[model samples]
Target chain A: METMQPALKNGRNVWDSVNMPKEEFEARIERVRTAMAGRGLDLLLVYTTGLTDCGDTAYLTNFVIRLTRGTLVAIPRKGEVVTFFEGSSRGLPSLKQTLTVGDLVAAGDLPKESAAYLKETKVNVGTVGLAGLKRMPFQQYRTLTSALEGCTFKDADDMLADFRICKSVRESDQVRRAARIVGKLTMFLKETTFEGASQRAIEAALYRQARFEGAEDFRMLLAKPGREGCSVGPADYVPMADGEKVIFYLGVEFERYWAEAIRTFTFKAGSFVEETSPGIISGFQQLCAAMKPGVAISAFCKKASAVMAGKGHQALAPFGLGGGIGLGLSEKPLLTEETPGELKEGMTFALRMTAESGDNYAMVGNTVLVGKDGGIILNVEPARPAE
Target chain B: MSDPNLKLEKTLELINKKGLDGLIIYSGGTCSILGPSYLTYFCEARPLGPRNCAVVTKDGRVSLLVEPVWDAPRMAAKAWITDVRGTSRFTDDLLEIVKGYGVNGTMGLVGGREMSEEVYAAISGKVKLEPTDAIVETLAREKSARELEIIYRASRIADLGFEAFVGCARPGMREYDLTAEMEYVMRAEGADDIFILISSGSHNYEMHEPTDRRLKKGDIIIGEITPVCEGQFVQLCRTMTLGEPAPVVYEKYRMLLHAFAESLAQIRPGVEASAMSKAMNQVISDAGYAKYCYPPYMRARGHGFGIGSIAPGGVIDDNTKAAFERLQAVVVHPNQYIPETGYLACGETVLVGINGIQRLAATETKLYVKEV
Candidate 1:
């Protein structure tokens, strides 16, 4: 058995050092500033709490913290960006290490401290936009509202969400990297012959491998062959059997970007016991081929459903089809009946199609980025069919 | 037949001994299960939905109050208790049910710290809510045969994870990739919930979250993997050296292994949980690594693992006073910090038997080495 190499040291990893070029970051900021001006907003207070908030914060400052508490990115209309993080004086060193010199601020005063800093920096808060205020706790909201009493706080969460919906080349690269890792692991699991292996053992192995491959955070949803439950965590004692379907929702974080894919595996060669119909393979292919830039998401969903219906497989609920992928495992450009927009170039999304043939359900999903010409599949492996 | 009621009787005896009027148990979603696990130990079935509360009185009249009106019927059918009521709004419904039961007198609230401020205010205003760790601790400290069966099964699953790591964990792989592979296998096998914390480095500062760092030729990857079975938690902490470990790393491993052994040796019925922690600290301190045993360096040596109670005893330092009881299951990791090696993971789950402790998981004590 060959020993593995160490991947982390002194609280910093390779992902921490991966930087989006300063020029590109400035360009994104300039785009956001233009949007702000069009919306008649003087400033944007882009707030994020816990691990989920890293996207907005990283958009302004290329910093990401792994703590459970929240961080706020205060983007003024005309000045440098500042961030307020949770913790005491002891956290300053780590704060400095993770954030840039101009972006770090003590969290003790929080909204007050942050608001005062912005005022001192000449932020005209008369027409400020606030994103992620719902995530802000009551106490923090009170402090910020008290500090910027004269400022009008309008919701700009939609603006931030819209801005992030389009993926940059750098962001696409990270997503592709994450997708490649998932592809390799999925292939490995298919080859492992999971009969008699308990759920806990399988989960432990996947977690170890994910860490070894540079995944910062991992979330998985696993369903056994016979048990078609919708739980997110790992189950214990349940063993793999000969003719069951396993739905695996795998997500990995690379450089603060999240990429997710869902795949269903079976252990035997046969259609589902009840339906005896062909699986969702053709449907998935049809959806993938139909998905193109400038196409309406609802139209895409309708086409996918039509393909499944033509194949005599039960079409999945429109909501179950996947959506955009980026900072969060699930993002915008959602595939729903009332989806309001069209797929744009540079937008990345998970093309998930689920079909039920008799008693068994088959799902195939992959992370793909919208290219000028067509859809660029991030993880380029064909779906593995059960033997 | 070994009486199934023995555990419940023992729990009630402990409740009387502690002089508590009643225990208020609440489960907040599946992730937070302080309420349901404690109630389920006496009764069966978990409360449905995100929020559910159960009050087990001294007279054995158990009342289960849950949010989401649809889940009440499911809760009633699953639990043996008769008084199960479902409420649409949690705070208002919770107050009315408690008031109806007249449990507003001196009552002990288990798992109330994580409750929202609105729930806390409602409960405190009506009843004198005293936070007690005893409610879940007494029932959860000792594992039942059924609980043990689930935990043992969970350990077997963890062992599969070990094998998977050995098979797939290689240099150049990203951390999340390995995690995804493991998760895929676990889910394929039928895992419900898994909590995994992994670090890869020769000098691991702490067993923090996973990162997207490609494994290097000589990185040592450590994982603290735990799978929550039913309501019980079974954990396995193991460290793997990717390539030939540095001599200094091996030395630190030996020291940690010895420290782990010393901690295990100290486990027995009636021993103060804190004493075992202190004894383990002494093993490291005597070796001139005292600073590593405390904060900014190392968090806790180990903690209790079970269905409803962690009985963490707060980082088992010298002044800690939590005691170990018979049948209690605990995980003691000699997770030490040294300037040479950041944090080396080594631990196991042990059941405090009548005589001594029995190891649950089937992992070897020595450092697991995988040559690159």
Candidate 2:
């Protein structure tokens, strides 16, 4: 008899850098079930749709729906979890290759299918937990409620949000990998970008390097100096003039975990060069310094405001500090004045802050892991680029 | 030169015909494929968030409501509707707009599925709600010259993507590497959005988002490269052989080519869309693969490609009943899984013309054999 090699439990295996081992997922399920049991929940239904809402479902199943559609995963207190997605049943062969969830069902109408599955499982009457319900289409929510008439549904987005806010060792490893790819891609952007190069081309180049490094999803938003309100996806193929400020807000998901970075570049003469803002850098540093374990996010916000004020800028208006970055581009525990959570140990955040002086606008961000000792900056580049 | 005014006039005409007070075209980002976001059609705007609703009154007054509340500046810049308002409170803001338009009488709803039950309940009692999906579909069935130009440009971008697919399909690279390269070429060429799926193996099942599986010698590569410009989508289903494939592979590919050719021939203005599927399926069935033409073996012969108005619906199986209209853009793929050659891809996007089908892509539909 041949002896089998033991499953490795270290930093990113070549194959499983983004995707953790089954044991990690099993442990997560145990944590979730414990929370659900305490809350007296019979089943937990995690509904996610479109690109932005894909994190909650990916956190549990490692199954992210790439298409612009709705997908749901139902986890009962006892039985196996099942996934329902908007695709043909024939596509199950492809789904199996991507996701580990076995009982996959093709759903034309998500709520109807979820209701039918709930009825079949004899979970007709119990307190149901609904995570990511905010993003669910109102039509589906009504249908789901009407179908499970005897059951009670409660908003449990915080349940998963709280669970996913803190990163495990393996999850942190995945975010670091994603951050490394973002760093390399941003560096490439700084080198190859030139005048007459369209936003589409610059974004395409970023995608090329990131995908080559095995990124699952790449999202970018472009804006000019005065036009700070960036839209989603690539803009028209318009060239930037020399001495103009061009901002690229980029986020990439490796495996299912996510990390994001923001950088501003100027078309100086003939080439693109990294631009810096002192006010933004000062505020960003203050936020990073305050990201200690057991500290409230509100305290960090106050510190960030003081740094901005001391730097001759106004108080931080909670406009730019980023949120949690894992499984989703922006998760719960957002670093804002109104955010309710504290910085816990094992938490990871994408610390981004922006400041304005005169007509110029500057933004900088980096992914950091909150450890027992202090915050560990996962990104290779600093929060703000050096002059 | 896209004409948002002309599209809006056509929508108003449909509302007048339907005997409604006005129309509410709802968009839930990319999720509403069934009743797709017609905002891009009427206002030349694509939504960034989950929900964006446009209310057009009978008096030519149009008000738009978008989510995230922050994208108002961007949305207002793109849309001609001056009464555009961004909202974080979707239901409340939209209700105010609907009431402000004095839409108390019978009203037409273009995207019924996009509206939640709560919104429906809040407004249905105040007005007679009529689903105007067919009206919107009819108006969008015929594309304008500008729309056709955009579709043509999108097709050109897809050709570049296919070229990159061929260039990047090396032996040792992962499937995602090829996908990335292809996407890079298309994006650089100015494709606003992209939907790429790839499968590489000797016996492939279906094209999906590229996995980390590395390509090897004699691997068969299948790619469904879709590039979107403005709102028009152009797709190309292509299969390439990594090395000199087996004789059986060539024979099966030829069968797919025949099916593709036959299907493209049936795509005239007057022909029903199902006829194209029937013609394509017939070619495969006649090639001693009768059992492989149905589900689990194959899916759609083609689907309509657009953001606002994907007419003839998204799927064009043998049971589809809609007829092809002139200027309508659709992809006619006869991708099949056969016992002899496994899954092979062969398809191209075409414009339904008065005379016959006009091929949109410059790339010929045939098996590409890459030498080892």
Candidate 3:
């Protein structure tokens, strides 16, 4: 999650009607409208900024901001939805081709543009539910609130997160497709030769491989096998030595859906053999099996912690026990000691479990879909390396 | 560009001058070529979390606070500050750290604009956070000797990126594939971050995110290749034709090349930054496309790239009031929508000084032709 932000998000750009149809968006909007009706809200503004924070708006409109810019979706109770994004007015022509919504405006200033649009549409005066509006830079937030003085705004981030925590059939399919890409790339990594190659060279090769595989955005962080820090970083320029083990924290977004996969491999003679602790592997399998619909998230996390503590393995901290993974890499209902939530079916997340072998620390993880029966790991064999 | 000791001295000076208890250069993780994280400049390390700040107290002690609670070791390893603490509760820890310092006076916030409403409101409740972005901008506008060296290295990576872009441009390859190839080559050369926008067609409106559109015969591939090294970014813009370029294509691109040169010639310290844009526009207008100098046709002629400030800002048009300064890292491009050959890209990054300009990249600013 701490990977460097790529300047140009040159990924697979598409608005697949079959995979993520307009009807899907219509359904999402309707769901939000239903929530709005209960809250007595007249309009909902779901705003986001930058590549990482683009999820809230992207959920409503299948448009992601490639660079650092503001994007928002405005859903009024009684009218067609309109979305605004940060870009030059000239780009509106080409940008229009990418969005599911017909009424889209490309503007330099989002708050100003939203205000002007609302003033023109006469929807400025009302109680509006604001979601992810806190992600904006303070200046822009002030400008937005000042411009829409007639509207009373309530924070709807929790409501929005509750709705977005669960994956729909199409959303799950999109995640499946993204996870498949991760699986294929893991096979690619396992089979490839890293002999005499710099860590960055491997990173470059992986970037190329993922892009060619139709991956839109790719990020990988390199960590030494024994490294204790959870915030694994970008690759250094040094070549990966043979017999040296490395752990990769990799994530890719396919058509707006994200899937992250973590695996550790021991390098020898240009090839990789996965290194997995039998105890940790068995523990993770049991933990995933325990991830049922009615399982309390904190309890599950506490149990995982207890198991790890018993095995003399410590939590990896921030990147340790994983959380929800969907439009954003980390969503709500995170698996933590004190986070109040339950593992509901349809909630998707990156499930990671760490193991210790002597002084070395190793981790294995994959994108998981919480199911009625249990946690369904959305990965191929050897991705988890337990096979 | 100042050394850590010098930065501390300056920070102390600013705190004393402003009558403040401390200074906090914050990072809201809104880092890009458009804007570099202010905290990255102060800390000399990129904090991989959403909320990180460098806290400089009046006691001359500087401590870093990084989010995610696990990035502390990484920050401690690289940053000049010895006290690097990572916290999951960023807002709470930041407030606690400020209270621990125990100064009830005001605090200067360098990147106050970057903070979200949640963070701003949270900090405002306990302490008065005032925006001090411009003060740091004025302090760091000029590059240090080491930063300049890194900029040159980054520019070389940009050149390599264009070389890769040229090597990968071919018929039937997707635009994103070309982007991947270019990015890989740059990454292989140690470019920290890459920002590339590309579009392929016979005639183009503007450069955008690389789509699935494959290159075809006679397609004009335009791109903005930016390779960042340690927060210093250098951009290269080039337009290549898949096949033999038309006569009009050659003619129009030549004008852009001339405009680029004209713009470069005007880039010395103390001159109004608008002079460069005015010069570039004059060449295109003189070539009988004066009507295409404004928007709906063209955006900014250029923008400055720096550690903490992308000054002269995004659009360096004739209306821009800022003057070009010494050691300023700026990317000057005449990327425009020309009716004759669609949009042709031509630009270079340069270091501004008394010597006018030192070109960062070795890539020639002209139309590239990929042989059929």
Candidate 4:
């Protein structure tokens, strides 16, 4: 329960290596039960609609919906957990393969189905904790409340978020696996960039390599030095010109765990040169050295700011430093001055630092795991310095 | 590039028509190809995380609030809205923006269904919040020239996807491997997003996500190839066989092909959307599968694909009364499950034209056989 089985121990299948074992899920459920008891909640209902919100449900069941649909998980304080899927009955076969939750039901309408389940189980009259309430449709919330009749509902989104924000040994291992994929992909990107290669071809190379390495989900953000900023959508058809500056921020999810990597490069004499400053790289390494358990995340932000400033540089606010990474790509304990939390041992985070020097901007990002000793850089795709 | 200002103009017109102080349209969750993320329709930048909101003031001012903080740059890079800001706290930033527009009058809220209850309460506590999904839908039903261009490009990618699905189908290949190959092809072709579902075996009940199951000779494969380019989506539900040798499969497939052709023929400007379903159902009924024409057999004849503006409105059933308009894009999938051959898929996307439906897919609807 402390550490997860390694994804690639000795030349196992990529799929076999990357997937979470059943013990990991069992340990997670035990953790949730303990947290649920502390909160005096009888049942925890996790509702998720669409792709991004599935983190809450996936934490318990490992069931991620591929399409844009609503899904709910009802975890009782004592017994079996039931999942209400957003699809039809025909999806049961696929659902069974993807999840371990035994009591799976097909619900065309999630709210109505959940209400019926609550009433049937006679738990509708008790105190129920709800996560992902904000993501649910308003009408469904009204329906759920009306059906509960006498039940008192409380926001338990943070309860789940708080539990998931910190990674376990296994979760950290998954992050490492995901980070490894991101590292390899970024390296491929660096090697593939040419004077005339289109962004489409570059992204295609990324997709091919990441998926081959068993990445469940992959997202990319790219920007030219002169562009307004980076976007997480399609790559344009424009071919790269010689000496054009490009910045790439890539993230990948393996076995439902997340990691990220960012690098800024300029296409030079038929190659890519790391368009970054020694100050920024030093600032990043300094920030990593500063990351320790019990250090307030805000304090880390201040330290990052100071590190950059001492190096005659300034990092961007809000998004520059980092945030906790685990089940979700950007989890709580965000590394920002305004955030009110402390970094804990066993938390994995992505430190993305963007600095502006004159008319150019450079960014360096990598996933780091907070250990008892210090921070461990999980996905290390080192940049080749500018010539 | 399409003028992001065109959407700003439309939002202003909507605000004026609804007599609202401002409009708040939001997209929840970054992964939804078809969720209530109408913000993409207005801003052109679909967020990649949970919760992005756009505030359109009646005075020609538009601002976007993006979540996950990292995507802020992406939103600014892609969206036409000049006042895009990134935030870690979604509800607070949303409240701040809504109040900036004088939050005392009726505020039209698009994508209300996807809004969390806490967000709704906070906003409505300040003003009269009204759901503007229908209004956005009405406006989105007619595509702009730029929207059509993106949708058409997405359709061409869908065609390439099917070509991959066909070219890569062979015995001994795992379903997921086939999916990986096809997705690589589409992604290389500039498909920004894709949702592929595959089911193999001659007795395929329905299309599902690819599994570890390996294809064998004589096993038929069904796939729904959906690709999105710049928020515009195009889908094709096609079927292929590892080897040709089934009279009943083709017989059942021909019925679906006939239904598909007749259904597409029913498309024209001003036609009731339900007519497409009825025409499709009639062909299935003539083939003596009327009992199976309803749910569990198939739920939709086709659905409109866009950000959130035009859905098949509802599933294309006999009871639907929504009418088609010019420039609306829809996928006419007549994928059916019958006792004769289990299930078969045949469909293509089309653009509703002034006189007839414009087919986006060049691949004709038929039972494509891969020579083993």
Best by TM-score: 3
Give candidate 4's error at residue B89 in angstroms. 6.3
Clashing pairs in 3: A8-B195, A11-A216, A12-A216
Candidate 2 lDDT over A138-236, as tens digits, reads: 678788878989888887878887788888889899899898888877777776745677666666777787877777777777655443443333345
The per-model DockQ list reads 0.12, 0.40, 0.60, 0.28
Task: Name the weakest run of 10 consecutive residues (lDDT summed) in model 1 chain B.
Answer: B28-37
Cα lDDT tens digits, model 1, B198-236, are 778767765544455678878888887665555565667
Deviating ranges (above 4 Å) for candidate 4: A1-19, A223-237, A274-318, A336-345, A353-362, A380-387, B1-22, B29-37, B43-49, B54-103, B171-173, B214-217, B269-271, B285-291, B353-356
DockQ-based ranking, best first?
A: 3, 2, 4, 1
Error at B128, model 1, angstroms: 13
TM-score of chain A of 4: 0.88
Q: How far is candidate 3 from the true structure (C-alpha RMSD, Å)?
A: 2.6
- lDDT ranking from best to worst? 3, 2, 4, 1
Instruction: Predict model 3's lDDT versus the native.
Output: 0.83
lDDT of 4 at A94: 55
- Give candidate 2's error at residue A196 in angstroms: 2.0
Could you give the CAPRI-style class of model 2? Answer: acceptable
* Among all candidates shown, the one with the greatest lDDT: 3
Worst 10 residues of 2 chain B by lDDT: B28-37
The fnat of each candidate, in order, is 0.08, 0.34, 0.72, 0.34
Docking class of 4: acceptable
Q: In candidate 3, residue A327 scores what lDDT?
A: 93
Top of the candidates by DockQ: 3
Q: Where does candidate 2 stray beyond 4 Å?
A: A1-19, A225-234, A277-283, A314-319, A382-387, B31-35, B116-129
What docking grade does candidate 3 earn? medium
Report, for candidate 2, the interface RMSD. 12.8
